[model samples]
Target: MLKKYSATPYVIWSILFIVIPLILIVTYSLSTKNPINGQLVFSFSNYRKFLELKFINVLLKSVTLAFKATIICIILGYPMAMILSKMEAKLQKKLIVLFILPMWMNFLMRTYAWMVILGKNGFINKLLSMVGLNLNLLYTRGAVLLGMVYNFLPFMVLPIFTVLLKIDNNYIEAAEDLGADKLTVFRKIIFPLSMPGLISGITMVFMPAVSTFVISNLLGGGKEVLIGNLIEQQFLVLNNWNFGSALSVILMIFILVFMAFINKFDKDNDDKGGVGLW
Candidate 1:
């Protein structure tokens, strides 16, 4: 049928882009060059090398920063999303445009703007020096973490906002009719229904935070070297594709595991009629 063939383009695109690239990466991760003839030979040396403490530490640091950023995004964005959902629709659109405006700019430019803002003798430092106090704010872990939260806050807000907007007021009314207070309605209904969007927001924010090189590079000034920086060095600077691919594979695996865990938690909530948040 014509309907069946309509999907052929998508199938071809996935095979060319997704399937082939993943295959190539896996092949590179499981291979090394033969010293004698300079040919790729099957091996696990790269993954073995990943077991080194330094590499493991980098991975741990990346995950830690990402986790912290995700938590902060959730804390800040959830209330904002709730407020937006309650606003008049026209005002909500205007506020959303304001939030999304920054994202339309280049990402590198945004990070550079942060560098200028956070740098010594930059805006904050200059303001402080006017009061006879100066502080070193840039090139710190906190600055890098703050940058991640700044860039990704919209990702967290929009998903939760979309989900909140879809929540039927009739459900709240029915719960209220059953003698449920506002707090009880939210605890037993609203929060649980919002879990899908929360999970999506967490995934969106955490994945990029874990793998972002520019934010760490610019804001942390190479002081906060993350796994992404190492991978970048291997591929672009050092020209070591095998090791770079190995690192990429490991990072992919860790991300997949985190996604799986989030999905499982979401599934559990759905199985419990979305009241598992209590």
Candidate 2:
């Protein structure tokens, strides 16, 4: 009886924060504002309105950019994680600390630092100017992609590294004793075992990359606006809370669908003996 009461605070907190806010968003999403009276009335017009071409294009662009960033993080981070996993314990800990050090700072500050570094008069440009090579690097899609990768690479590395570290050395030795080479052992054993971490890394990198507004705003120089930016504009600039709520609901749906899709892959990989990304 006493233990049951102990959970009361957490349950109340969840209801107050999570459940109430989600309810309000759903209500606003399925509602409309009266132009003259300025009252919210229940309707689906807000969700329907976002189906227009311009908004769809923004959504597609966000997905594409996030997909590309996730792929790049996987490619770069996998090798790093593998190397780190093979390192001495002390060295691995130090390197992992160094890798995640930047994340200790505020997220906004980290994005701002990239803005400074990628700006026209920033360090890279100054170095390029010394060699008489003028190139526009900032305020571009590539800049935004770079910012995402830099900010979220640790998310990719840490999870995969954790999974890799837990793998039994005996498995590798047994495979080698059975005449399997390094690549074969990895392909047959290590890669399969690491699927959970890889999936986790992909989720961590892709979700933030897709919904990020700050990196696109500062690094893409406001030229590239993602779904996140559009949602922000609706809520803050246009004062269209209904539309913003609809957009938020749509974004939430996208995230949930993606997570479900990845979880399917996770389930398939667990059942089979191969890598599963499709």
Best by TM-score: 1
lDDT of candidate 2 over 130-188, digit per residue (tens): 99886788899999999899999999999898888888898899999999998999899
Instruction: Compose the digit string of candidate 1's lDDT tens values, residues 125-239.
Output: 8899888988888999999999999999999999999988988888899999999999999998899889988998999999999999999999999899999999999999998
Give model 2's TM-score versus the native structure.
0.94
Model 2 ranges off by over 4 Å:
1-3, 272-278
What's the residue-level lDDT of 37 in candidate 1? 100
- TM-scores for all candidates: the values are 0.96, 0.94
Provide the global lDDT of candidate 1 against the true structure: 0.93
Best by lDDT: 1
How big is the positional error of residue 187 in model 1, measured in Å on the Cα after superposition?
1.0
> Per-candidate RMSD vs. true structure?
2.4, 2.6
Angstrom error at residue 247, model 1: 0.6
The global C-alpha lDDT for each of the candidates, from Candidate 1 onward, is: 0.93, 0.91
Candidate 1 runs further than 4 Å off: 272-278
